[model samples]
Target: MEKETTRIEAFSDGVFAIAITLLVLELHVPLIEETGGGNSLLKKLVAQWPSFLAFCLSFFSIFIMWVNHHKIFKQIYRRNTPLMFANGLILFLATCVSYPTALLSSYYHTASAHVAVAIYTALFVCINLAFNLLWWIASQDRQLLRPEITDEGIKRIKRNYLYGIPVHTLAFILSFVAPTAALFLCVALWIYWAYTSGKLDLKSK
Candidate 1:
């Protein structure tokens, strides 16, 4: 007997919520001396810009991932063992985001910045690859999809997912050579994905 997609989706949603919430823990309050005034506190906050940037980027990335996950699961009618494992992989990688976000926040501008950025981008690459695999598994011969979902829609989703692998891989490579540029590319990818909104036209041929 096949399992309903609801259980998987509910579990995935919990993971998303936990990951996003963990991101906030990376933003620490700055310590000030007794003589420090309001202006000094403001300066300290400004100095923690890297933490703010990492938090925003990771939050948006996970948010967009959750939205896309919802869109994909809407077309999936049932799940098998492999499909469950695939979805689990996506969530597993997503849960890893908090660690890298914290690393990037702490070392983004320090001498270890490149290493931190590389690890950060590498996690995203893994996440992207996991998504590609999950989509491929779910859409294979429409094996797990709803009856109303069309072949053309599956193909479109696969094509879009395929695009993410190389782009993220490139960003990972750039992390070694140009960490800042790679970080920017990662942000750009998130923005582009958010703009696309992951909605498929199930009625399309």
Candidate 2:
């Protein structure tokens, strides 16, 4: 079981690395004025707010997903077929998130921006769903969880995941009317996770 889990971890890590690389491909050189020198080029690039915003959003979103995946596997000492599929599903959803995030950033002021946000939120929802499924499947047989894990720890993790998905999804939904405000809320939640997960009490063995 350990060997199988290790293989899954390795394969997933490779996929994640590839996904992160692909996300950056969306950023490109902004068109600069022909006569205006270095200052013009810099100003043009800075004016391309969409590219920077998309890059930041996608990078952080993927990073957080990777962190959560690491946390889940840390708690699971073994693996089974269901866990394998669940991990695959999570990766699949994660790969889809970048495109929508980029799309939303590009079309942020347009009428179709809402659709992009919806797609982005939906992909994250799918990711969280797969996460929950993997946790339940692995815990059902006790084949994946560490033997010493407490029930309360399991409950806390589940609660954290459950609470997070809705907040994230709703933030995306609300981007239609108040995109800047929604984006700020999303950033706040990301900060919360970063700080909370770093706590000694939240660390898993």
Candidate 3:
């Protein structure tokens, strides 16, 4: 019999879709007809700077999560119930990130922004933890993982999670004391991820 698709995979896809869509909703339609000029339209958009910032961060965060999830799933041949559930938790946490991101953009430079950033970073760390748990279970079971993948490759994957969690945790804490610095650190982290993803051994299978 063909193996049934797991709940986790389906739920993750749904959650990611929702999260990305929610981000765009933050953008308001410009009342350009009232202003009646291209310059006015541009100025209206510029005034909603918070929405633009939210859109950028939300888009990047959703895309990164999707890319990372895709890479992890590509190596798996099948999924068990527990694996599916673990992935669901990760997706749930990921979904929560959008709200905080929106809040951060709207209330940035205020105490609310600190809370929002902290929540966003916490969601990220939780998702990573869930991924770590899912990976550990799959690696321990062996059957779920691709046969040709090396222990070293798996270790490297785990290492990525290890590093990501702490960095995010630190950023979360720092947001209260220095939100701007924390944000800059996160941007730097993403740049590092861009470089590292290029270096990952795609031939690990």
Model number with the top lDDT = 1
CA shift of 146, model 1, Å: 1.3
Q: Cα lDDT of all candidates, in order?
A: 0.84, 0.73, 0.73
> Which scores greater on lDDT, model 1 or model 3?
1
Candidate 2 regions off by >4 Å? 1-4, 31-38, 199-205
**Model 1 pairs whose backbones collide:** none
Please tell me which predicted candidate would have the highest TM-score against the true structure: 1
Question: Could you give candidate 2's per-residue lDDT for residues 82-201 as a string of tens digits?
Answer: 778888998887777678867866786577766666666666667767878877787687656776677777777777677667877787678776766667767777777666554314
Taking the tens digit of each residue's C-alpha lDDT, what string does model 1 give over 17-114?
99899999999887667328778888888889999999998999999999888878877878888888989998988889999999999999898888
- Find the number of clashing residue pairs for candidate 2: 0
> Positional deviation of 143 in candidate 2, in angstroms?
2.7
Work out how many backbone clashes candidate 3 has. Answer: 0
Better of 1 and 3 by TM-score: 1
Stretches off by above 4 angstroms in model 1 are 1-3
TM-score of each: 0.93, 0.86, 0.84
Ranking by lDDT: 1, 3, 2
